[model samples]
Target: MLKIGIIGYGTIGEDVVQAIGKDREGGIQVTSILVRDRSKYVVPSSLADLMTEQEAVFFANDFDIVVESAGHGAVKLYGEKVLAHGADLIVVSVGAFADEALQKRLMQKATERCRKIIIPSAAIGGLDRIAAGSLGPMEEVTLITRKPPKAWYGTLIEQQVSLTELTEPYCAFDGVARDSARLFPESVNVSAALSLAGIGFDRTKVKVFVDPHITSNTHEIEARGKFGQIMLQIQNTPSARNPKTGYIVAMSVMKTLRDRASHFVIGV
Candidate 1:
């Protein structure tokens, strides 16, 4: 069985554990989890074998793969370390890679160690098409994200306008993926992932919308290139425990791990 280590024990982390536990295929199992505060969460005693130290989580854990559902800071802190230790690291926080310097350094470290960094299609779809479209000459790529106004409260958009009082759909910001990730770090991973897969960050455009009428987070991608134009949209419900993260993101991570551990993998 492939042993998996999770870097975050929040909503996404817990969800991954639950999904793996219920998976009848029995190909992969979550061997351990890393969290800053363990006492706050109730972990089952039956799965105590899966629990381990927090400080030495990365270096000490014995696992084949490390899944990072943690925030960008966690990715920046432990991403290279995980890959350097000869383990594949699956990063869910794709927005962190928007920093070209950091991305280059991580790739360099991974190359030196002969390990790989995997980016999952979290909270979005049609990545296969987007990646395929890259084979031809690409002209433009745009990602538009729409979410409830409440989701924008703590973000920088809060300063510009009241999220509660928005009567109409408002375009909070419009710029490149690099700027979007830098500006709204918590909400733009899909854009960053699309940018990396289709075009470079500078060339990929991003637009964030705050709609009072919308309940779920919506993502739309439109691309035009020599392969022609492709348009895709995803409407995602927030995770029940963590409203900030879409539930589909966790599902995508689980799907990636399952595919990696399975004998017959489908859809690269």
Candidate 2:
């Protein structure tokens, strides 16, 4: 059985466990769940006993892989430690990689330990094509994200446009993927994924929209290269627990985990 450890027990974390039960054809087990306040949330009967230390790096040696679904802050805090324990890491908070040095350092540690730092195609798809196209010359890659106004709360978007007073869609940001990821860390993770898959952060363009006119979060990705022109668009339903992100992000992570252990794998 493939033993797994999860770093968060929030909405996405809960859904991941359900997903494992839904389909674990290849024998995947949740051995541990480390949360900030374990007392606040009740653990499922099957996984109650595996609740373990959130801070001890050596504790991760018990699991084959550690999944980080907490947030960017958790990545900065414990990511390296998890990798140092010689356990592979799955990062749901890809936005945290916007810090070039941190990403490199973590990758370096994973390499030294012979472990992998994996990032799921969270909240988007078609990254396979982009990654493949990297072997050839790529011309352009762009991501346009539209979300509800409340999702923009506390973001730098508030300084430029009034999200509350907006009646229609407002382009709150237009920049490269790096700046977009840093500026809108909560919602623009798709930008970081795009940059990582295809071109470097500076080359990938991004546009963030504060759209009160819409309920669902939408993203449009366009890429052109030797592989040919491809445009992928998806509208994601917001998570009930947090409006700042989409529920599909959690499902995407679950799918990645399943594929890791499944006999049949899809995509590149």
Candidate 3:
């Protein structure tokens, strides 16, 4: 079994735990969960036995992988440590890579420790095709994301426009993927993933919009290169626990874990 530790018990973390519970034979197991404050954490009945608050608990176990579903701060705190401890790191908070220094450091740690840094397609799809096209001479790669008004709550976009009173689609941000992660960390994991896969952060273009009429989180990717032109779009229902993230995000994480132990695999 692939023993794993998960950081945080937020929406994505809870969903991932429940997913692993549902598939007991998938060859993945949750060894421990690290939370900020165990006292305040109300563990779900099913996962009560796996909760832990100490950092030492992670190092004690023979964890094959550690999943980071917490915010970027958690990634900054535990990313290198996890790699150094001999477990592959699955980073759900790809936005943390916005800090070039931190990204390089974690990558160096992974390289030195001989552990992999996995980035799942949590928010969007078509990354495999984009990464493949990147081998050729790629000219331009762009990502456009649109989400309902509620999804923009607590984000920096509120200062730009009134999300609640918006009548039409409002463009919240337009810039390179690096700035996208800085400005809207919670909302633009797709941009960060795209930038890393297709091109460097400085070269990848990103646009974010708040659409009151739309009920789902929408993402579109367009790339033109010597390999060819690729255009893809997906509409995902927002997670009920958190409007900022799509429900499929957690499912993608589960897929990544399951793929590791599956005899038959698909996709890149």
Candidate 4:
């Protein structure tokens, strides 16, 4: 069985573990989970014996892979240590890669240990073509994300734009992928993933909108290059616990974990 260590037992991490538990015979199990405050959460029976402090994950030899479903802070804190210790790191918080130095350090550590820092397609698609286009000449790659105004309540958008007064959709941000990912870490994981696969962060365009007309989180990706134009739109349900994260994001993590244990892989 594949032993998995998870960083942060937040909404995404808990969902990932619950999905794993549903299929106990999938050959992957959560061996250890690290959270900011363990006392606040009631972990499932499966992880009751394996829960530990965030630092403990670095020293433990029990897990083969570490899934980072934590936020950017957690990734910065434990990412390099986890990879340096010889465990493959599955990064769900791809937005954290916006820190160029941190990204380089984690890549260096993984390379040194012969481990991998895996980035999964969380809530968007067409990355295979985009990644291939990177080898050729790519002209443009734009990611436009839309969510309900309520989702922007506590974010920067709220301070700049009045979500309550807006009756229609309004574009809240327009910038490069790096800034978008850093500014909206919780909601824009797909931006970083798309940027990493298709182009560098600086070149990737990003637009974020708060829509009173829409309820679910929507992502529209447009890429034009030597590989021709590829456009993908995915309307994902908002995660019950986290409005910033779409429901499909957690499922994507589960799919990535499944692919790790499966003998026959489907997509790239």
Candidate 5:
């Protein structure tokens, strides 16, 4: 069996473990979890033997891979350590890569240690074509994200405008991916992923919208380059336990792990 370690015990992490446990293929299992408060959260019976981040690093040396579903802070805290231990790390919080210095450091460590870092297509699609076009003379890339008004409640948009009073769709912010990540850290993973796949953060345009009519979070990408013009959109349901995160984000993480363990892989 392929042993896996999870960096967070939040909704995405719990969902990944549950899906793996329910899969009858019997090839992958979550061996350990790296959580800040193991006692505060009730871990599933299957993963009762959870470990702290430090302990997880010790186990990562033996595990097949480590999945980081934790927030950006956790990624910055333990990413290099996991890679230096010779374990592949799948990071769901790709938005953290907007920090150029941290991204360079992580890449350097991974390269030096001959380890791999995986980024899943979270809540967005058509990344393969985008990445391919990046090899050519790409000119522009844009990301537009739409979510329910309540989704932007605690964000800077909430402080700027009343989400409850918005009767129509309102574009809250427009800037580059680096600025977008800083402005909307919890909601800009797709943008960050696209930025990393196609162009650097400064060149990727981002627009955030709050829609009163939309029930689910929506993401759209438009790109123009020498290769051609590509447009893609995805509407994702929010996780029942965590409204800020899309349900498809968790499913994407599972797909990434499955592909890693499977001999026959589909799509890059």
Candidate 6:
């Protein structure tokens, strides 16, 4: 089995564990779950035994990969440590890579250790195309993220705009992907992913909207390059436990894990 350690017990982490539990053929197992404080969370009965607060126990040599489903802070805390521990790292909070120094350090550690630092296509698709088109001259890439006003409740956008009182669509952020990722680490991860796959963070444009008219989180991607222009959009249902993120984000992580263990992989 592909033994994996997961950081965080929040929405994405729980969904990944539950999905892996239900998958009989995935050949994946959750060896450990690292949480900030075990006492703070009333973990489910099935996951109770796997939860641990000790960094040493969680970074034990038994795991083949460590998945970081926690926020950007957790990435900065455990990213290099996971690579140093000799396990491949899977990062769900891709926005953390916006920090150039941290990104370089973690990448260097993974390279020196000969381990992979994987980024799952969470909340969006067409990354493969972007990565491919990037080989040639690329003109531009832009990401427009529109989410329900409720999704912006605790985010920085609430300070810039009255999210609760927004009767129409309001553009809260319009800037480069780097600043967008750093500003809204929790919600603007897709912009970072797009920038990584297509262009550099400073070159990629990001626009965020808090729309009272939209019930679901929506993303629109536009890219132009030697491969030609392409436009893609997806409307994702928000996670029941966390409306700030999409439900498909967890499914994408699960798929990434399964692909690693499967003998026959359909999508790359």
Candidate 5 steric clashes: 0
* TM-score, predicted candidate 1 vs. hidden true structure: 0.95
Model 4: residues with Cα > 4 Å off, grouped in runs: none
Write down the TM-score for model 3: 0.97
TM-score of each: 0.95, 0.92, 0.97, 0.96, 0.95, 0.98
- The ten-residue window of minimal lDDT in model 6 covers 40-49
Error of 1 at 61 (Å): 2.4
Q: Write the per-residue lDDT of candidate 6 for residues 192-255, one digit (tens) a residue.
A: 8899999989999999999999899999999999999989999999997899998799899999
Off by over 4 Å in 3: 44-46
User: Compared with the true structure, what per-residue lDDT tens digits does model 2 show for residues 1-268?
Assistant: 7888888877778888778878737578887788877678776667676665556632645878889988888899879988887789998888889999999999899989999988888888888888998889999999999999988777888889887799989988888999888887777888988899989899999998899989888899999989899999889998877777888877888777777777888875
- Pairwise lDDT winner, candidates 2 and 3: 3
lDDT of 1 by residue, 195-236 (tens): 888988999999999988988999999999998899888899
Candidate 1 contains a number of clashing pairs equal to 0
Residue pairs that clash (backbone atoms under 3 angstroms), model 4? none
| Candidates in descending TM-score order | 6, 3, 4, 1, 5, 2
Error of 1 at 149 (Å): 1.5
Q: Is candidate 4 or candidate 5 better by TM-score?
A: 4
Predicted candidate 3 versus true structure: per-residue lDDT over 51-114, tens digit per residue: 8788887578889999999999999999999999999999999999999999999999999999
The lDDT for every candidate, in the order shown, is 0.85, 0.84, 0.91, 0.86, 0.85, 0.91
Candidate 6 ranges with C-alpha deviation above 4 Å:
none
What is candidate 4's lDDT per residue for 109-134, written digit by digit as tens?
A: 98898998988788888777789888
lDDT string, candidate 5, 189-239, tens digits:
888999999987999999999889989999889999999999888899987
Cα lDDT for residue 249, candidate 3: 92
